[model samples]
Target: MRAYERLLKYVSYETTSDESSETCPSSPKELVLAEALVEELKQIGVADAHVDKDGYVYGSIPATKGAENEKAIGLIAHMDTAPAMSGANIKPRIIKDYDGADIVLNEKLGVVMDTVTFPHLTNYVGQDLIVTDGTTLLGADDKAGVAEIMTAAAQIIEADAQAGEGSAHGKICIAFTPDEEIGRGADRFDVEHFGADYAYTVDGGMLGEIEFENFNAASAKVHIKGENIHPGEAKNKMKNASLLAMEFNSMLPPAEIPAHTEGYEGFFHLCGMSGDEENAHLDYIVRDHSMDKFLERKAMLERITAYLNQKYGEGTVTLNMKDSYYNMREKLESDMYIVDRAVEAMRENDVEPIIQPIRGGTDGARLSFMGLPCPNLSTGGHNFHGKYEYVCIQSMDKMVDIIKTIVRKSN
Candidate 1:
């Protein structure tokens, strides 16, 4: 089956991961897709295909005859959708030969995807686009990745069966992970058991893209406590925590935000905020490509916390900060050939490689640090993690061919 067809089947399972949940998979619903994937892998000739206790799926295809001694290559993709939008009951429709005009996603909800806001729509004018119905995200962030890997695996198996020893290639390993959106996709991963000298995560945006560098990530949570007083009797008595929380946000660089930053630039994003008269909270994520700059960003947050606490009471402001993942370029620098192979594979398929740094982290980032030397490959998707998300059919098919070329033996 085509990769997009498999994606339609995969998105029907409703695999939105929960950030608040402490479970391994983060949500029990992810296991439903995991189990189904295991079954599909086994049907495709991966005899040992199985889902682990933590909802990670693993399968492998043995190298043909003389190619048994060749190094193994792994393909990885996440199974769960992001929590930023709802993934339940996704109704996707295909726009065949897009006209480069505004798309009315939902007439009743008055939701329209305009070309002015998303000018990238012009890029897929002659191709088919699979989009959502304005109520939920399209789940193409990584499901499109999963489908590409599966379709490639199926084609490899079929070719090997027909050509026998003539179709020589290295061992191919496959894994589908859970909770990638919440940053725990590689927490319980068994990298040693995966048995790949190197891997490529088919979990990126746009076609012909190969990403080896990603953000050095950290999350910060700030809490403020204030003494409430009657407004009529208050002179300097009322210290509103809500106002203090706003002050803390104001201390951050106004220009250094997701909206203003691009390429190698760093940013402090305020993901969530809640406040009242006596108590308030701010949640933020800090990201930078440079390790030194990443440390400085964290230190800036610490300094702001200290200043707020000294100005208010000693126990007024409390800060909780933790590092998420570092840039994978540090780990993949020595094994840059893996990245070159992907670039060559894309060119072989007549697609020009776009080697760019990911603005966000992928499971491959953490996996590379864990001794796997993995880079990320595109899934032909655009506008991920929202209702306006889409994937190009021709791009998905091209990615499938590119993956096959990456695994197959050269002439």
Candidate 2:
């Protein structure tokens, strides 16, 4: 089957990961998709395909006879969709030969994707676009990547069979990870076991995009403790935690927010916050392309917490910061050959290579730090984690060819 068909089948599984869950996959439903993918891989000639206890799917295609000694390359994609939207019962609509106009996702709900807000729609004027139904996300973020890799692998297997001598490629490793949206995709990833000299996370946005550098990420959880008292007596005795949380938010530079930042610019994004007069909590994610700036951003949060604690009490405010991932550029700098190969693959496939810094982190960034030197490739997805999410079917087909080209070039 084609990549688009595989994508349509995969998205129906509802593998939306949960951040609150402590399980390795973060959601039990992810295992269902993982098992199916494993079976598919085995049918595609990856005889060793299997899903691990953590819900990570792994498979390997051996090298061609003459290329047995060549270095192994890995392709990775996440199985779980983001927790920000409902991935269940996704009713996707295919717009063939798009007219470069606004798309009506749900006429009854009056939901539409106007060209003014999404100028990128103009780029895919004549292409087939797969979009959501204005109710749930389409889950094309990495599902497109998964289907592309699977189709490419199947093609390679078929081509090798036709040769009748041996395979026509080097060793190829494939992994479908879960809980990538919750920032734990690499937590239990057995990089050493996967045994790849280099890898790529097919988890980027847009076609022709190649990313090796990403944000140095860290998550901060702010806790505010306050004394509750009657409204009439609240002035001196009561310290409203919710108001304190707002004050804490106000202390940060309003200009250095996600909406105000772009490119290599860093930002402090408030992901979730909730509170009451007795206790309150704020969850923030800090990101920067530069390590120095990332540290500065984290330090700024610490300074704000210290100032608040000094005013309220030593233990009134507590700050907890944990590093999620670092820029993969540092790891890939000495291994430019990997990036060069990807660019050449795209060029050979008639796709322009758009090398840029990723504004967010990927599993590749963490894998690179874990000695994989992994970069990121596009899945042709846009407006991820929302109801209006979509992918270009033609772009996905082209990506399959690109992956095959990369594998052939590696050999």
Candidate 3:
């Protein structure tokens, strides 16, 4: 199948991962798509295609004849969609030759995207686009990446098999992972088993994106214990947990938020907060591109909590903090060619490479630290993980070309 064809089909699988689940795949639904990918990989002539017990699909295409000496290159994409939104029953609309205007997703529901906020629609004018119906996310975040990799790999194999005398330089390793949306995508990746000299995760948004670095991330949750009293007779004896939660938020830097920060800047995002008198909880995610700054942000939180406890009481607050991932640029700096190949490939294809540091984390960031030296490439998506999600078909086709050219020239 073609890249868009595979993308449309993959989105129908509804592999939405569950962050609350204890299973390796997070959600068993992810395995449904993983198994299907393994079958398709085999159909496309990838040897030993199968889904591992941990729900990762691994496949290999042997080197084409003359390209036997080239080092193996790996391409990866995630299987599960984000758990934050509904991934079931996706209705994808293909806009043929898009015109820059307000797109009415569901006419009766009165859903429309303001061009004022998303001016990038002008960039995709005259190109075909696939979007959601405003009810659920389009699942294009990484499905487009998976589709591009699968189609490109199929084409490479076919080209090598047809012209056996002039093949690419080496074998190609491919993987489709589960639970990437939940941050455990690389926990059981088994990088040594995939066996590639270098790799790229086709999980970025927008065309021409070449991401070598991303935010250093950590998640923090604070549970506040409060004394509840009857509102009718409430006085200094009562401490409203909800109000305390608000006070806790107020202690953090106001300007340091995702809505305000961009491009190498750091932020403390308040993901969730809940509870009332007697008990309350606050959830925050801290991110930065620098390790020292990331640590400082976490320490600042600790300091705030300590001060709060000093005034309110020692047992008033409890904190849970965990490090998510670090910047991949540190690892990629030693082997910059991984990023250069992607950039040069875009330049060779007449595409202006948009090299930027990702404000969010990716599977590649953690994978690079795991010794794969991976970078992120574009999957041609926008408005990811929401009802406004969309993908450009032309960008998907171009990504396939980029992957093919990389393999053809790497040999």
Per-model C-alpha lDDT, please? 0.93, 0.92, 0.89
lDDT of 1 by residue, 242-351 (tens): 99999999999999999999999999999999999899999999999988999999999999999999998798999999998999998988779899889899998999
Candidate 2 lDDT, 133-206, residue by residue in tens: 99999999889999999999999989887875434678999999999999899999999889889999998889
Q: How close is candidate 3 to the true structure, as a TM-score?
A: 0.90
Comparing 1 and 2 on lDDT, the stronger one:
1
Q: State the lDDT of candidate 3 residue by residue for 1-411, as single tens digits.
A: 679999999999989999889998998888989999998998888878999999999998877666667778899999999877899999999999999888989888997976887889888889999988889999998999999999998888788777755455577889999999988999999999999888999999898999998999999999999989999889778888788778888999999999998888999999998898999999999999998999999999898889888988897888899998999998999779778888888988888899899988888888898989899999999999888899999999999988877666452
lDDT of 1: 0.93
Query: Between which residue pairs do clashes occur in model 2?
Result: none
Indicate the worst ten consecutive residues by lDDT in candidate 3: 160-169
Model 3 lDDT, residue 79, Cα: 91
Q: Please provide TM-scores, in order, for all candidate models, with all chains considered together.
A: 0.90, 0.90, 0.90
Root-mean-square deviation per candidate: 2.6, 2.8, 2.7
Clash count, candidate 3: 3
